[model samples]
Target: MLLLSLFVQPATKTQAATDLGLTVDAAILIDASTGKILYEQNGYESLGVASMSKMITEYILLDAIKAGDISWDQKYQVTDYTYAISQKRALSNVPLREDGSYTIRELYEAMAIYSANAATVAIAETIAGSEKAFLELMGKKVESLGITDYTFVNSTGLNNKDLQGYHPEGTAEDGENMMSAASIALIAYHLLKEHPDVLDTAKVTEKTFREGTSDAIVMKNWNFMLPGLIYEYEGVDGLKTGTTDFAGHSFTGTAVRNDQRLIAVVMKAVDANGEGSYKARFDATKKLFDYGFTQFSEQEVLPAGFVVEGNESIDVIKGKADTVNIATAEAISLMTTKDDVAKFTPTLFLDEEALEAGVEKGTVVGKIVLEHAEGKDYGFIEGGDLTVDVVTTENVERAGGISLFFAGVGSFFKNLWGGVTDFVGGIF
Candidate 1:
């Protein structure tokens, strides 16, 4: 039989960013693998998250495609309202021709790479019956991501008041679509981590819809920073860029450098005179990416089956074996600065002590605790208390009457003790 040895190291903190800027209105940088925030500024601060809303739209649309709710090859009819909205300068039009049918894949490209409002609304109406229902779905997806500071009132981020069918260009005084810088970063992280394939769309600098169709419209990429923003930055892919008179400017940009990928968000930032400046977004992203790549490194904190020294096995009574293997469900890793990486480790704890024998397999043992050098708790890792029956490989016949007689005598004494206790209780 092979034995599985469990070794658990105490949790410790690895080195991390010492100074992430605090002056930015809202900014956040997180480790994609572990969701650890390396640098943050006004992380929870809420502001108008312009085209960044499309990131959520991208996620929902892809989910529907995969779930068989919609198919890429299926062509959709473009409504008159969808056409009118596409014509507005304030909106990012996909240049779609009315009645010019397009596939789900084509629409996705327009929405993801170009932040096309028309493409977004078309996809929204198809999946959720109406744009409002789609927005509700977007909000639900946001909540599922563990984000608490955000709300979605429309699929296109056109502001709530524009839904009235008037003020076609959208309104500044409308109920604003809101989100935090950290939340936007989280959305980016989700795209890369959960749906890496999204890069296939985001990375594209250009694409055309309905090359064969007579009324096909051409779509241009909205994010200008992708082509030639930074010399060292290559494989810099595409992500949506958003700006409204009231929402200011917000951008969620992701780039790949060698084997490393980073996602960053800038909210409430504008140009020289304060008009949704993509340049500012580009510059801000450079600061975050440089800081992350140069100073931050990913490190494994715990390995699977990590054992707690004192709680390796629990004592069980009347069972084949006295104890069972207690181990973690999976390994944990985190991103930290170089200095703190050395002290990182996994700490385990048993919520309760071992049970007296006779415990069955798969019983709840206790929870394990993992911590960092900063004393921040990572999360609880749990273990199971199971009974392993002890059996001999080879069978042996009873060597005898004498051994049998001794076993009988022991049983007799146990019964006698029980009887005596019963008699004493009756007398009392």
Candidate 2:
């Protein structure tokens, strides 16, 4: 990997949530297209995630299905523990008979829509045979995703105490899954990007489980910010909500209006009086959404064919030409304040092998990523620099032996002079 840098002359702008007065312990808003953090506060501090952790569980299940290890029509039988947990009417659940076998589709609908704990446990058991084992799978998946800060103890995000001594081992009896706002946002980011179909069920505002049957129950989504719901936010679609004594009220929300989409998360939200309520979480999320939509807009940071100043081409050692022209393969747009649109510098990272002599005209040689000139880059949740491919704009053929001999002589003198100067300096 070749490192490159650029200079830009401007200071960009950012509007902090502190100025907006967000009422959450932690929060983050990101652009869905580029994964750029638009706003954040206390985003790295770990806190209870409640059922928002279900997004990770949803990811695993979807992956298993995609891998052919499981199927949507697969049947699941509730275990004694999951059955008992489901029987607690105080918890979010639809009645599940111990003798009943349900399809994975229906159970997933329960978990994603109503935040049903029992249905989640059943899905966990079906996929991994037990919640404890499923926890291991979740761990491996998290590690593979490069997440380093998290505490996941169960497939369901319920406190271990809620598991009735049947919780997964190696966790405190009273513990619930916890993750930093940035970390959980990363989880949701992966889930939405990897399995966007999760939105289909997540966007369902209300549905009846087992319609026309005695056990039928109406499942209204706990995400009140969704369209046609109580709070009724337009352009809102699929996402999750969570609530518990430990988690207070948290939400991961996504919405798109006029072709721009934003994902926002708020944890432990409180009202003006510092009291937690479902409304408080939604209200805080609204602030994030409003700030993202109003304070920021997408701007093309670098256009295709962008070339680094004074480094427009790669030096070719034995090519027909002295160098090959290379530039950004595509345009990159970032979500930032309109005033900050022209304040980004693109840093190029070149691939020496790809840029070598005789390389094809369209060969990809590097990548270009943008940073705010005034040092205001929050970066993406995936922990990777948002970049666009850089490719050769034209090719250079291998030079003839005679031309190579001449080039080699020039290179030798250049190196000899540099070495002589360094030797004299060192002696002096």
- Model 2 TM-score is 0.89
> RMSD per prediction, one decimal?
7.4, 4.1
- Residue 210 of model 1: what lDDT? 66
Per-residue lDDT tens digits of candidate 1, residues 1-428?
A: 22222334444433333554423467777666556666666667788886788888888887887788899998878888677776764567766677677788888887887787778888988888777667678878988878878866677776655544632233344766788887787788776777788888876666766667664656666666676533225546856677876676666777666666667777766455555465666667667878878877766565666566755665543334445666665555556666665454444444444454444444555544444446332221011221122211222233355755766798899999999999999999
In model 2, which runs have C-alpha deviations exceeding 4 angstroms? 1-4, 8-18, 348-356, 364-369, 401-428
Clash pairs, model 2 backbone? none
lDDT of 2 at 128: 85
Candidate 2 per-residue lDDT over residues 155-233, each given as its tens digit: 8888889888888878899989998888877777788888989899999999999899999999999999888778878
Off by over 4 Å in 1: 1-17, 160-173, 212-218, 225-232, 270-276, 303-313, 319-331, 342-347, 355-364, 375-428
TM-score of each: 0.74, 0.89
